[model samples]
Each structure stands twice: as structure tokens, then as C-alpha cells.
Target chain A: MMVTGKKHEAAAAPSGAKLDLSHVSKVFRGGQGVHDISLSLEPEMIHGLIGANGSGKSTLLSLIAGQRFADSGLITYGGDHVNEHAAALSQICLVKTYERSWENYSLKEIFKFASIFYPHWDEQLASELMDKFQLKGSKNYQQLSRGGQSMTGIIKGLASRAPLTLLDEPVIGLDASMREIFYRTLLEDYSNNPRTFVVTTHLIEEAENLFERMVYIKRGRVAFQGPVEDFAANAVYASGPATVLEKLLGDVRVLHSERLGGKLLLALEDLSGPAERRMLQDQGVELSPVPLQKLFVYLTLRDAENSQGGGNR
Target chain B: MSYRSLMKFHLKDYRRGALILLSIFVCVDTALVLLMKFLPAWDMGTADNIFSINRNIMSIFMIISMIVTVAITFPLMSSFSVTRRNFYVSSLLALLAFCITAALAETAVYLIGRAVLPSIGLPVDVDRPILLSAYVFMLTLLDVSVATFLIGACYYRFKVITGTLLAIVYFGAVSLISQMFPSMEYMENFALFSSDPAMLEPGTTLLAWGIIALCAGAGWLIYRRTDIRM
Candidate 1:
């Protein structure tokens, strides 16, 4: 669904093999799970899955990758139901910090296993990425530092080149310089061979630019999923006299607000059209675009604030 | 393609362990046979065929090997995008191949011993045939390997406490059924080949095959429904 404000038009015909989830739910013990998550991903674009630590981003990715089975609903990829279809699963590659499977194996040994099993595995790409990442072939997987481990996971995801590649917290422990290298390499790889990628990460501002579409998950459901531009275009930061701002934002959705002296600063959702902006501008209010990261923070915190029965601090 | 890849991966993973175990077994067996021949003071009148010795050794090793391999391979199966069904089938296939190879290797070792021992004046009286004619021996190896796989799957699908408790209850029920049916002589007779290599009765062979099928089927069900913990 479009964020509370903007009305999205019918999307273009799906470009390629789409990843589709319909009413999927997977509940773990203690009631932690994704609930009724229905999303369709068009092929050959990067989508960012942004959520808080317990917001089910990781769980949703796992279900999509077929690493975990859904309790109810259907997950399909490229026209095949992934849960029971081995061929369909083979088309998707999930790169996670798998602490168990390859812990005893050396980096070279893991590469061998990856190349053997992944149909689209690119040995040359893997070797090149390994060199770039400076990962030693002889080091045991479990022996690597956290960043070193993340580098190995990144190489696997990029080199697999499956139709749908998922990287959950791919850059968990990388330094700033290394993260830059990852982004550059990721972009280069995507350009060289386009595919669908769903990356779940906490470094939103750093990686937001790379995402063509953004999916905001809150409390196990999709709060928003649309083009990144759509998300950013929907939120506006407005500041003006407190009384004027209150009257101007009368019925408009105020996601976040701050009282600075007598002037009030507000983050409003779905205030994109020229008519609303012009009307607010005429009322002597200053407006600027809210960054995707700030909008995410505002939306998530607003929900939490409402649930807890507290006004925005 | 996925099945073949999984089998190759399993073989690679198990290569080191299998080699070490086989090497140790062969070395110990060969050393003992040589000691018996060269040092008469150490030699006993008792006959020792490599196959007979390994029949017991391999059964224990195979069970351990199967359990460890299944535990290690289960997670890798998901990482490599191999389906749970394929993982179960491919692992079972790998174990079957491993058992067949071990069976053949034991037979060859026995044949070699038959030739080499006499030349060294330490002939062994192998009462049982070296290969499939030792039907109960081969069946025991296969049964334990598959049963151990089921145990590993159980531990994987359910964590330790629940898995262990369930296994105890299930085995207890099986024992109760076996006790209730005194005519199920195969349960007791299957291990009798250690003393004598009497041919397994056709009915007993059928029952043995059925039990193998049941264990393998149960293992598959557990694996098929298991969710990979990321």
C-alpha cells in the first residue's frame, strides 16, 4: 500500500522474473514473526529492506529466499512456488553470515562448495572479489574478524549472480572505506549483470542512495513499499509560526513535530502535490525535502509513540 | 544437478574423516596380522579375517560417521540452495555408496589376507563369505547408518531436549512392540553372524528391508519439514 499520503498509479508491467509473496506469515516461538507480508518485486533493481532490529526484515528475507518455510500463504519466484520447488530456490541466492555451515571450512573450501552448488556461480568474479576484499584462502571461516566475515558473505552474494540475490546485513562490520568499496563493487556488478537484490541493513543513510525502491517494515508488516523517490517525495519538513502551522496542518498527517521557540517544525507525510505545497507556501511556511533516512525515523517513531500513548519527544 | 552437487559436497566434506578412519583400520589390522605371523609368541590359534574384524568396527564407525556428516551437511544444504528433499535423498545415496565401497573393501582385504596370510603361515578360517553372502553384516551397516541419520535429523528438527526425549519414547515403543511379538526373531538373529554366518531367512530379509525403509522415511519427513535457522 502507498504510504498514507501519496496515491501510487498502477505500476508498469513486471520487467522480469518477479519475486512475489502473498499473505505470507511465519511465526516463531514468543510470537516473533512476519505477518501477512505481501510484496512483489520487479526484476533487475535493488530494493532496500529497512526496519528496526525486531521489525521482521530478516525474517521476511529468509522466507523469500526459501531458507525458512512460511506457515501460511504462498511465495513464488519467476512463476514457480519456491517452498516446494527446488529449481525455483536454486534461482535465488541468499548471503548470510552463516556461522555453522562453513565454520570448519577454509575460505577456499567454501568457495569450492559455492561454485559446485550455485548454478550461476562465477568463479572468476568470486576470485576477483576475494582479492579485492583481501580475504585469505587458508583462513578458517570462523577465524575471520567480523568485517572479514562480512566481506566473505558479500563476495558470495555478488559472485553468485543468481536471478534474485539477497544480502541480509551484508556490511555488518565493515569499515567506512570497505563499505565504500562494497557499494562501488555492488554497483559495478549490478551494471555488468543486472538482477534483483533485496538488502536488509541498518546503515540506511549510507546505502539509501543505492536503493531504487524501499520497503519499510514495522512490527512484522510492510509499513511502505515503493520507489525510493515516492517515499522521499511524500514527506516534507515545514516550519512556520506555531498558530499558522497548526491551522495549515489542520487535517494533514503530521508524522513528527518540534516546537522551536514560537515557530513549529513539522515532518508531514504525503504532502507532495503542487497544490498542497503552494497552499502551505502562501501561508508563510518554509518547506524542504525530508531525507529518506529522516522520514524513516519519523514514521517508525511516530508509530511507536502512538502505540505507547505518548506524544513525539 | 542439485542432487549431484549435494553428493559431491558431502563427499568432499567427509573425505578427510573417512580417509583417517580407513587408514587407521587398515594399519591396525595389517599390523596385527603381521605380528601374528612373525612373532609366534604373540600369535594365538584364533583366526582373524579383516572382513570379520571390520564388520564390527565399520558398523560403529558408520553410525558415528553418518550422524556427524548429517549434522554438518544439513545447514550446508540450505546455504547451497539444495532442497531438503534432495539433501535427504542425496545423503542417503552417499551413505549407501559409502557402505557399498566399505563392504567391497572389506571383501578385498579378506581375499588379500587369505592369500597373504598363508604365505606368511598365518592362515585364517573365514567361515562367512566375504561379500553379500554375509547379508546380516551388510544389513547392520546400512541400518545403523540410516538410523543414525534419523537421529541426527531429529536433533536438528527439534532441539536437544525435545529430540532426545522423543527418540527415547519412540525407541521405547519399538522395544515394547518387539517384546510383545516373540516371533520377531530377526531382531535378535541379525547380530548372530558375529558368531556364525547362517543365511538370513527370506522373511527376515524382507523385514530388515522394511525397517530400513521406515527409518529412512522417518528421517526424510523430519528433514523435509525442518526450517533452516539463519
Candidate 2:
């Protein structure tokens, strides 16, 4: 399915500037980075870039934002090469956990710099966010607590209102309440302005509700990319008697399986249609939808097992 | 327009640091000149006059300012989506502005000292304050360009320790070469301390400009391809 997003008024490109990455690869000296990634982000939608630690999510975001050039293939936004076109770059903002040189600058100063570069920067929203986050503009960045720093990055990402905003681990040090505030603020802003936001976080369940679509990267390759509901729909957990489940799921791709006191639970991928689920249910087997976090874990775990020359049952 | 904004941003980055350095320069120079005038028995050595002292101080200040500005502003600018080409151009402009401002301020101080010291029964040796300031501007510009290139190249490619060691080795080799070849001593003197306008050779000025261009070009080559890390 083609990912489509809402039109952004302040975007430099024409209304339908979907972010396109084709055959993209970035290999580091240590041989760990994204590989052969081809994906298109629909405009004006909140996308969850979910991945395990060192799964190349950050690298992919950097490549998209044009902060780092790709070693091969192409990344384009609005029909322009993002890395080579200033206008395309101006419309994208990638907010990291910490800006290395921002420590010495006051939050106000940082905002001023952002306002200068980002054509659609919302100063009023930035001020409101500062108040909401309980961050003083006069406070230098280094003086802020870790949560405060995270809040600062959040404010910048939300207020810049760029056409394509990528936030990497945006809620790293935030408390539960602040994280909720961040989510709400992000949703509210998107409601009002309607731009694309790609957020990468480990707090999958907490942020799952906010993502319209999800892209999961495992071992530097895209494992899944679709609507959140579809991602959940792609797999299911079936529980039944160990012997019966083993016999029934012999031909299926079982991502994970565990036996507990004569009962066996298996994560099964590509279990086609309602007939298969009904068949399992008729056989005294219980079928339940797998949660997103669990699905991610099971998927990655399967990849790990496969790579290690082991079968996934 | 982006270039202009970047230039303004860089100038702002250097403003506070430059002010602090200027204040220190003024305070120390003022205290020493006053002591020389008040205490006749305290011999102000021939090479230890206020002008010479201020020149050395300004050079140090400019070097520090250049290194700090590049180190701090490059990442900051990159974070704001400023292009590498714009950043390099704006940085050079800001550094040039700083050099000119410092040169003018140093000239004013020299003029004031020249006027006051004679009335206070102290002999002033320096002349042609305007020419001196122009030379100072050129020299400071060259120094800062070189410093900016070295700092940027080091941070982007070589780590700090390796860059520092490389710098030390290069300077050490130059020092050894100068010591071995007495004729090359003039070039060292021309580069470092050509205070007298009459001794300022056109070739020296041209060489300084050429070196500045080389540094700027080499710096851009390194910077344009550099990936802005975090």
C-alpha cells in the first residue's frame, strides 16, 4: 500500500512530497548499519520507527534527514534529493536526544537559532511548550536535568513544524507524566498542523496508540512496515495442549513457542484467515492477538534464531 | 539569506568570548603601562613595551576565539540544517569581522598610549598606527583561518590527540628548519613579528594571503564531506 500523508502548507515541495528511500544502505566501519532499505513514508502521518538496540533505526533517521549521506542508492523528499537540496533539508528536522554543542546555549538562544533556520517555526508554541514542560528559557541546556533536556528536544521537534520531523528516543529520560504530556502535545500539534512525524522509541506500548503506522527494523533490515493494526494482525499467539499444538502447527512458521505444564503457547506468523483461527478454536486451542511489543520481540527473536542456524519450530 | 543568518549566528557566538578577552587585554595593559610610568626604577625592558605586549595578547586571544568559535558553532549550525557551504563561508566572514574589529581596537589603544606616554615623560617607539593595524588585521586573519582549518579538520577527521600531535610535529619541524637555515629566519620573523611597517615586505603579505586561501580551500574540502555526528 502507498503511504500517503496530509498536505503541509509551509513545505517547500509540492503537496504530495512523500519521503522515498530506495535501495538505501549505510555500512559503518564495524559493519552495522541499515542495508538495502526501500521504504516510503506517507506525508503528514505519525510513524513509529521501532527497532531493537543498535538495529539501525537512528542510522535510518539520519539518512532520511540528510544529516548523513547514504553510501549507496537514493533518498528523496518532494522529488528532490534530500542530502543535496537545501530546500528539502529545510523542511525536515531530526531531533536527537542531545545536541552536542547545545549545552552552553540557553534554551531561548537555541530556540532563536531554530526559528532562524526553520521557516515554519512556531515561536508561540515553543514558548507554550517551555511552560508546559516547566523549562525556563533562561536556563542553559547543560544546567537542565536529563528529563529537562529531553523536554527541550521535544519542544524543538514539535515546534519546528517541519514537513518531516524525526525524533530519535525523544522520551528517553522523561517521567510517565511528561511522556504522556509529550504524546498529547504531539497529537494536538499534528491535529492542528498536520505534518509527518517519525518517532523512534523503546516505549512501544506507551507510544503504540500514537502511531498511525509502524516500521520495525531488525538487525539493520526492515522486518515490518504497515499500519499498527495490520502489524498486530500479521501474527497471533495460539495456546493449546503441547502435543496437539505440536501436531497442528507442524507446517506453520512458529516464531516462538514455550511449554508450560502440558500447555504450549506459540507465536505463529502468516496464519491465514478466520478459518485457521476458527479451526484452532474448535480444537480446544485458544487464539489471542499478539501485542505489538511482544510481536516485535518474537519477530527479532526468530531472526536471531534463524541467523544462528537454528529453526524457529 | 541563510548565509547571512549563519554569519550573524557565528558573530553572536563569538561576542561574549571576544568581550571577555578584550576586557582582560585592556585591564592588563593599563595596569602595566601605569606601573611603568609611576615606578621609574622598575625597568620596562626594550621588548616589553605596551604595544608589543598587547600584540602578543591579541594574537593569543584571536587564536582561542577562532578555535572555540569553530568547535562550538559548527555542530550548532549543522544541527539547525545549515548547509556545509554556507557554514564555511559564514565562519570565514565572521572570523574576518572579528580580526578587523580587534585590529581597530588594538590600533585605538596604541594611539591613546602614543599620545599619553609622551606627555607623561615616557618615550613611545611605534609609528604609523594605521599601517600597523592593517598589518595586524592581515596577520590575525591568516592565523585564524589556519587555526579554524586545523580545528575543523582535526575534529572531523583525526581525533584531538592525533591532531594535536600532528600540529606539534609540524611546528617543531618548522622550528628546526628555521634554526638550521639562517636565511629562513627572516621568513619566521616576517610571519611572527614584523611590527615596523618599513620592514613589511609585499611578498610577505602575499604569502600570508596565499596561505590563508590554501587553508580556507583545504578546510572546505574536509568540511563539505564531513558527517555531522550528534
Candidate 3:
């Protein structure tokens, strides 16, 4: 098993335009919360948080948004702790899945109420996005379809223009076309008005182009956090004759391996060294890019396997 | 935004419903008054006058409204990123305003009866406005809001069964305390004892404030640790 990165508190590092969570942990009654998670999100970039279901992605976002307080550790945005500080919390807007609490409110009314708190709420942009999404202003939130509910939340997240915006499953029930539109709208709006956005979604391939960085959370800890290219490059999916692949792989750590039609496919990590590349070339082994979705599955499966092994002991 | 703006937004939810309910209540009360005026020969002796009419019915409805509003508003405000402290402060002020409005409305109804009843030969012999004690009305409203808000906060923090159990125990304890202390009985009869000299005594006020403080403390303790489950 690959060693997980240690969460360190480095003051004066990643200075300015960053949201910092240092050794934050929030444990619920049934032991179903995030643990000792530390992450630093820089501004004006789109970041993706990918993990299996129940892997604490939402919990981390909740802690950052002040929806839940950490059991320990600190979260700071723009140099102010967000747990109880309104000024600091105002910097982030979190858009969650459909909530029945909004049933009594019309979309326009919800916007009117929320605009009061968010200093950078863009009324025109919200109106335009609502119109584009075909979301009726007069309909109560409960009256909308599932995709419409997602649209309302997306509109809020985008229009708030908070320095830090977190969207949890923003496209849960969106159709293919709506999902495409959302991606385009997000990228265009993000470019026009630069701000930080952290999105967690299951459809990684669809949204991978919009992400500059990806954080893979397994169980309650971060398995990986780095640039998207670096994450894709951190592991290689090699396929060739089983004998040649084994020779090429040598001592490289294999996260996942399988045989397909008399050939071997292995997810090899830490294979970026020149020596390993030369060996693979000499053996004529094929190297495929590990997409974010497969990377997430492989990492989470590895974690689950390790956890089960520990439990059996 | 300012606290006043949030208070207005929170209070706005009750506007239409309150208007409709109060309108129906006033219409029915006025119809009753008119019927009494027309039937001058029918003297139902020992009947309570309008100035002394019990408002427990309205108070019960007020208690339910407080609970429902708090239950609904907590999550809604949290979704809007309003802090728990801000919500509590705004709700406190809004509840106070609601109590004052209720008190004034009750007083108006009695004053209207006093003006109309005597001219129609229906005499009110009470020493003062018998059913419109602002102190009693305010205290009762405050207690209802605090107790119901606390129960709603409990529900926000726990599951339905646990929340329901906590709510029953909380309300039962309040009931037990009110029953055990004779002074606390004033919560049910403040208007009845409005003409008594003991109405201004400090004991009831102290007890009422003490309960309010306890409720506030308990509510803050629950709210600070709660996760906003969206």
C-alpha cells in the first residue's frame, strides 16, 4: 500500500486567495464523518473532489461551509476562521442537493433572501441563469423537477460569486444536454469572473476538462491531492503480453491488475522514473492514461481492501 | 445585511396566515358581540363578559405556530448561510414583536367591547381590562416560543424518535414545574388576577425570566453543535 501524505500545518504557506483546512476532523454519532483531513484550495481555479459514496466528500465541504463544526483543527479562508466568523464564512457558498426546507420558497424569493447575506450576489447573472435553465421564477422549489432543483442550486452557487464555492453533486439528475450546458456555463462564467470552485461529482469524465486539480478522498482521508495532470501521471495503466508486462513492471507498485484476452493490464503507481520508462519501452509494453473515474475506483477499492484486512486482524 | 432585515424576512412568513386567522377571529368575536347587543331581553346571568373572555384557545394555537415556525426556519436559515447565533437573535426579537402585537390586539378587542357594550346597556363591571394583561400575554408567549424552539432544536440535532421523546419530557417538565409552584399558576391566570395588587409582584416575573434564560441557554448549547443536514 502506498503511504498517505501527512497533514501538516504550514503557516505562511500558500498565502493569499486560498481556503485552508488544517488537520480538521468531524466525527458523527455513528462514526460516519471525515477524519484529520487537511486541504488547501487556491483561488480562481476549478478543483474537483472525487471519492466513492460515503467517503466524506460532503462532510469536508460542510465543515468548510460552516454547516458543521470540526471536532478539532481549524479551517481558514482569507486568514479568518470560518467556523463562527460570519465575515469569513461569507466568502464561500455551498450548493447542496435538493432540500425540502426550500419547498415553501419560490426561486425568486430564495434568491432575494440569500442575496442579503452574500456580498457578491449577482442579481442579473442569477436572473439570466434562471432564464437559461428554463427555471420558472414563480414555481416553488418543491414543484420543480429533479434537474430543475439541481439547476436552482447551481444558479445560486454561480451567481453568489463567493470567493470560494462548493457544489456537491450539482448535476445529480441533469440530462446529458443539461449537463453539457452546465459545464459550458461553469467554464465560461468562471473564466469571465474568476473565482475558486470545488465540485464533487460522480461523472468525472464529463467534468474533468473543467478541473485543474483533483482530490481523491477514500474513506475519511485524502488519498491524493495534486494537479490533474500530475494525478493522471502518478499512475500508469500498462497493457501487453503478461511476460513482457511483468518484466517491464519489475518492482513498480501495482494498485490493480487484471488479465484481458491473454494480456495483462496493471495500474502501476510511481512509474514516472526514466529507468522505468526505458524498461517499458524496451519491452514494448503499452501505457494508457488512467482517467479520473478509474483512478477513483482503484484507489477506493484499495482502501476498502486494506480496511477489511485490518478488520479481520 | 443588518439584523433588522433578517428579522423582517423571518417575520414575513407569518404575515398572510396571521392576517387570515386574526381576521376570522375578529369577525367571529364581532358577530358574537352583535348578537349579544340585539338580544337585550335575554340576560344570561353569570356569563363571562367579553372583557373577561378566556384566550387559552388562541394561546394553544400560538404555541403550535411557534413550534412549526421554529422547526421550519432553522434549516431554511442555515441553508442561507445565516449563523445559528444570528437566527436565534432575530427569532428572539421577532417573537417579542409577535407577543407585543398579540397583546395589543387583545387589548384592542376589550377596549372595543368597553366602548360598545355600555352604550348598548350591557355593563362591564370589571375593575380593569380583565383579559388583556400585557405582562401575562408577553410572559406566556415568551415561554411558548422558548420551549417550542428548544424542542425544535432538539429535533434538528437528533432523530425523530429521540426528538419526540425529548420534546415530551421537556414540555412535561415545564408542566410539572408550573403545577408544583402556586406562583407559576399565574401563567394560566395572569389576566384573571389583573385587578389584584399581587399582579405586580416580582416573583412571577423572576420565575418567567429564569425559565426564558434556561431555554435560551439550552437552545444555544444544542444549536452550536448541530450539523445543518440539508
Best by DockQ: 1
Candidate 2 structure quality by residue, lDDT tens digits, A236-305? 7889988779875565468788888999998888676888778888888888888888887777776776
Q: Is candidate 2 or candidate 3 better by TM-score?
A: 2
True contacts kept of each: 0.64, 0.43, 0.45
Off by over 4 Å in 1: A1-15, A240-265, A270-285, A303-313, B26-57, B108-127, B132-134, B169-192, B199-203
Per-residue lDDT tens digits for candidate 2, residues B1-230, read 36766766776777778889789877987887789888988765432255657766766676666666567677787787777777778878877777777777777776787787778887766455466445545564455546556655676666788678756754665467458743333334322444554445444455456556766777787777677775
Ranking by TM-score: 2, 3, 1
Which candidate number has the best TM-score? 2
Query: Compared with the real two-chain complex, what DockQ does model 3 have?
Result: 0.56
lDDT of 3 at B127: 44
- Pitting candidate 1 against candidate 2, the one with the higher TM-score is 2
Q: Using DockQ as the measure, what is the rank order of every candidate, best first?
A: 1, 2, 3
Candidate 3 per-residue lDDT over residues A188-230, each given as its tens digit: 8777667889999988888889999999887788878989888
Please list the residue runs of candidate 3 whose C-alpha ends up more than 4 Å from where it truly belongs after superposition: A1-16, A246-260, A304-313, B23-54, B113-132, B158-183, B188-204
Per-residue lDDT of B46 in model 3: 26
List the lowest-lDDT window of 10 residues for candidate 2 chain B.
B182-191
Q: List the residue pairs that clash in candidate 2.
A: A5-A43
